[model samples]
Target: MAFHEMLAPDYIFESSWEVCNKVGGIYTVLSTRVRTLLNLFKKDKIFFIGPFLHKKESNIEFIESETILDSWRKYANEQEGLKVRVGYWNIPGKPITILVDFLPFYEEKDIIYFQMWEKYHIDSTVAYGDYDDSCMFAYATSKVIESLYHFLQLQGKKVIAHLNEWMLGMAVLYIHKYLPTVATLFTTHATSIGRSICANNKPLYGQLSNYNGDQMASELNIKGKHTLEKLAAFYANCFTTVSEITGKECTQLLEKKPDIIIPNGFDSDFVPKGKMFETKKVKARSVLINVIQKLIGLSIPENAFLLATAGRYEYKNKGIDVFIETIYRLKKTYFDRPIIAFVLVPACLQGARADLKERLENAVSSQFPLPRPFITHELVGPLCNDPICEYLYYLNFTNEDDSQVKIIFVPSYLNGEDGIFNMVYYDLLIGMDLTVFPSYYEPWGYTPLESIAFHIPTITTNLTGFGIWAKSKGAKSDTLDLGVAVVERTDDNYFETAEAIKNIIVKYITKYDSSQILNIQRTSCALSKKAFWSHFIKYYLQAYDVALRKL
Candidate 1:
């Protein structure tokens, strides 16, 4: 069958734990894709369902809309005792949203789990932590969908309930059992087994083909979550993944092949351009330099290169180890300019350091180093326990008087209120001369894409989906000539990966001229254009088509 001939959904409903909640990369996927979806479907035809929390305590990303779905809202409340708030997401799309209050469903948790086991074989009896909360919310979302389908009296209209990640996979099973006519699509951003294996220091990519997912899940004590995910993938009308790399992981780890690959894409509407971009970059650099100077008590060189690596604090999975190794190697090389690297990954921080705050407020520049000179915030635990800090201490890159390479750990979320920089992540990201994310287990790296979106060249390993995509489009690994360096990496090639990154940084600092650097920056921006949602939304349409056809 021709791809274009597939049926299109009249009403599309997307459910996720990250919806209206900025937790991780899946939030980026759903929020960024909204504008494109809004353009295709009517504003009322699209709905994003998420768990509702108290408005005062939650960082709510939704604006309540009482009039939009008033009729269905009343019907659901009166008939099914379903409590939901209709709203518009405060994003580029401003699409209609339904935040369901799942607290009422807590009493029915055991019954819901039993039904799940009987209908779909999802075992949640041994589930703990986020299992109960996510399942309750998913159950609430399913009720909301059923109410809407009935209230609207649309028995035959094409509808899609797309659930993202394992947290929301219960909704797919719910729809499969109750509303069989509603086409269901489940997208597992990353399999539980795959991530667990990586976190446990197991060789995932190297031994992927040989490993039995169920055996690994049982061994890792993640069988419950893995079973739920596996069943969702098996039962969904169309099972999709965010990247080709994750597609392979899903096939092996979940025991199911993805119906289609819907790669994550960036929306460039948030990025600044022209003189505005330059102005933001200047402000960002000033903020970064000021904070570092206050903490380390030394004014860095004017031409010092600013670099960073930011994401969830997954040391090995995100390649913080290799990043530190590369920085250590770069310190021993003969480079004239100083390099200041920021490890922007959030960790357990006890607010900003009192001494650092006092220095920033007083604008004092003391010659003596602070207690922990390289770390910006006071850790909640012993400083010796942090892998990145411990590794830096082991390597002796402690921002000493004679050290050319300075590493500062900003272990707080950059939400314009990190006390020191007082700048959001994107604000600080634009000031970077380069970014490095040589990840060992990245599905679709958003940091490198965000770097290139800001027109900063980056170094990432081919193990990442973005790196492979960039290489297929003629990206070079050893040079910043093509904007992104795609380093070849494997389970056993840790030192080689580190050495490759070190060589690239050395080349950029020693060989590239000012004009050449400008060219690389421009090339990075051009490559980012290829990843815009305008170009990648077709893959999602394909997935939607497959789901509808399955109905």
Candidate 2:
């Protein structure tokens, strides 16, 4: 490979805090991409590095295995004093994954931070909470990379180290300093300061260009993470983001325009084939309807519409605030059938509601609502001060017999054993007639993409990355006709955004009959096919090319 030509990577080391760990949207993004990545790169050459927590978690979730890199593993353990495990990740491709036990690095954190500050100018003193743990993991990942690079003799080869998020920012800086031969690509899913501003209820979109990221980070007390991310972006050979929306965010907040935009692509395998999809839909809808019926003690008709809003519990950021209000508006408007909205957000919880579980198990039906009919699980503290729960209370959702509109708060991860709805999130998602993620500050918005993949027409605002991409791909402006409704949203137009989403649903249900509805669902599935990694992997290849060319 020469400096004049675009270089192809012979090996790629993809590192993330959520490589095997199922945490957030990054997990979904990476796990789904392994198969497609393997198609372009050589087999067994792409390695994913993640943090190793404990023996039990490793044993349960990982399959420890032998690979050609065994020599490097041995060297890492004996010379580097690093606890590491080489295994196959339990996801789709089961890609070769190395989980480093980063706990040992805590003893040397101070020295490592000092070294980082000395070399890369990263500030670690102001870091708090998960900062130290993430940095330690990142440092350990860099060490693992160093050991593997020498052992594999990849010095002259096109070796690319792809690091994701600020959690792995240190790895980017470390690789650049220690292994200059290895091209580093650092992708920030979202700018730390941008997310912090939104999480703090500040108007991000309305005054984005005017806001100084450094100043906001200082005000938000996230300078450590912010500076780490900013410098990492500046240091990396290639800095990329998930979408153009986040690309602009990275430019504005991190002050470094991304080298490329690697839009998130879904795996077709997640969606069941032909009859399997319908079967899963039947099972999911059955469980969903049964749970709501048992809790609300109402006969939820077989054809009643099932709506959902699921994601991280960023109430204002994810537009859960607007969603709750939309449900109120939807309720105020007349609908001929029963409409039930499930808020599938994981939050602080004790356990499943014992009463609801018993009722679901017994197949009990009642004409009266339970004490806490609005929520399926019991929150940690007394009826609690949860925003969603409180807002529903504020709206007075009675789930009454004649109300025809009901909202249920499922404050648990729907991972097959939430004790109430024992189905996984996807299995449950396939059942939804419509999904809404009116996110105010969504960077990439995977929920809507997931919903559309499941062939469920979804409503999201233009403020989201997926929404922007969908619009560019000719997603209808104010209709569910294209399977996605990208509603207009701004910092101040909360009510308008909510009404727009509600109106899409209302119009969708009122205008289309059974056949037209099925066509729209199929159209959504087809649209999602355009976002499959098979199609979007070209962008990543471009990133890889650019990264190696810089070398």
Candidate 3:
């Protein structure tokens, strides 16, 4: 039995998007790891404390956590910078305590967005030059931690605050000064500055010589937050990054060295636990038809080859342009099928969205078959309209024929609405012949890993943190002949991408034998099993054990 299972603490407090809120990979970490973490500890011992948007309703009752309130009333009266409300509300089905603030920053006359949708308008800079809603988000997080610590102290429970990312890193720093007994654990999944420069193909440091250096510097100045990151790195009792490559980059690029490398893993159990590549032939075909039918309704070819690319909206960084160019060139030259590439890429579509759309369309010449000309299709058709309906409408629309060359560009935020988001993508992978992720910078890609898990051979670049690890572990790459191809981003030719796509499409169209396809599927399952949960969850419990021992 694990040491955590033995020690079974009185309480475990975790904060991230996944628990009650979810953003990206961090959400996965919180949801997957925290559940297992709770198993090691007691269920009642864990409390996930984070700011709840007042509009977002929860089943937990808002009983005045008099302990937290009393502690905060005293602390707030004493400190000036820490002037904030600290109270608790019970989340239903569980004794979940939510730490919230009703300070000047959090004061709202009327909450505009009750639903926790990623609102881009709120992301933009205000005319008054005030900070974005993210600042309030950061401030509220600090207050939450403060409130939780106070509650813990009043109960005489020793507390360990494990913070994920730089925003929470700041909160840890704030609370540590006041609470000496607190053990702080900080994890930087990816630094914003490192990611920005890497994605833009600029030097990680130093100005771009040809452009406005000052303006560029101002836009890319992650130094202020990173200083806090570095301090957390040096000061925190424990620090970890998601991948080994990212760990090195944190030290070398961001100057915030990580003490440990907790390479990210998926909750294998959450994904359909089955033979990874069992193609329910009829079910697979039906799913394929359902995906293609929607595109055909949009005038795309029913038999068009579907090669998908889905991720967050950083198009340039996610290598959407590269994926588009390859598809466009292939559609123009090779197989004369009507190509429909669906883009489920998400961005804050408030300002530059039109620009992003225009850029994507312009990149792919309008001389193709459809009125749009470019193959890139949105899961949610346009920027306007209710996204839920947009997602549902597409999901509900289906075609009679299943086979088509469809590429779905998925934006990151899927609220489990329209059931189609994750389901459709999975269908595309199992039914479609190929998936490509030509990322220039990925902290740790779940897409290609997911693709392989689904029994679809994927083309991933060397630049991705996962790809690097795969190469080290002898993950295969073929000249368009086998399952799972790894192409080096820096070394591979631009034409090589098109050539590879053509070869794969031709193979599928001409000679994808059942045995060969099944072999690929089985390979995917083998890979998935190799990276199972039992192998990794212990690391989290162990890391905490080490951290507490240090304390």
Residue pairs with colliding backbones in model 2 are none
Work out the TM-score per prediction. 0.97, 0.97, 0.70
Compose the digit string of candidate 3's lDDT tens values, residues 1-551: 55535322345556543345445566555554544454556665566666555565542334434564465556654763444333433322233455444345545312422211132122122112222243455455556666656655634555566777766654555556555566677777876556756666674323322333223324675444544455656567777787776776676655556766776665554345455434442355455444333323444434545566777766556777667666544543444564555555555433222423453334433322332222223333453353322432443322223423334434434443323333444544555556788776677887777776666667777667777766765665543334566676542355675466555555654576667767776776566555444556655655565555566
Q: After superposition, how far is residue 454 of candidate 1 from its true place, in Å?
A: 0.5
Give the worst 10-residue stretch by lDDT in candidate 3: 120-129
Q: Candidate 2: where are CA atoms >4 Å away? A: 1-5, 55-60, 66-68
Q: Which ten residues in a row have the lowest lDDT in candidate 1?
A: 51-60
Task: Note each model's CA RMSD in angstroms.
Answer: 1.4, 1.9, 9.5
Ranking by TM-score: 1, 2, 3
Instruction: Give the Å error, residue 179, model 1.
Output: 0.7
> Model 1 segments beyond 4 Å from truth?
1-4, 55-60
> Over the full model, what C-alpha lDDT does candidate 3 score relative to the true structure?
0.53
Note the Cα lDDT for every prediction shown: 0.88, 0.88, 0.53
In TM-score terms, candidate 2 sits at 0.97
Estimate, for each residue in 1-551, the C-alpha lDDT of model 1 and write its tens digit: 45458678899989998888887898889899999888888888899998788653344588987798998888888889998888888889788889888999999988988888887776686566788888889889988998888888768899999998888878888899889989999998888889989999999998999999988988888777888899889999999987788889998888899999888999988899889999999999888888888777787776889898999999999999999898888888866777999999999988988899999899887777787899998888898898988998899877887778889889999988988888889999999999999898888988899999999999998989899889988898788788999999998899999999989998888888999999999999999999999899888888888888887
Candidate 1 vs candidate 3, lDDT winner: 1
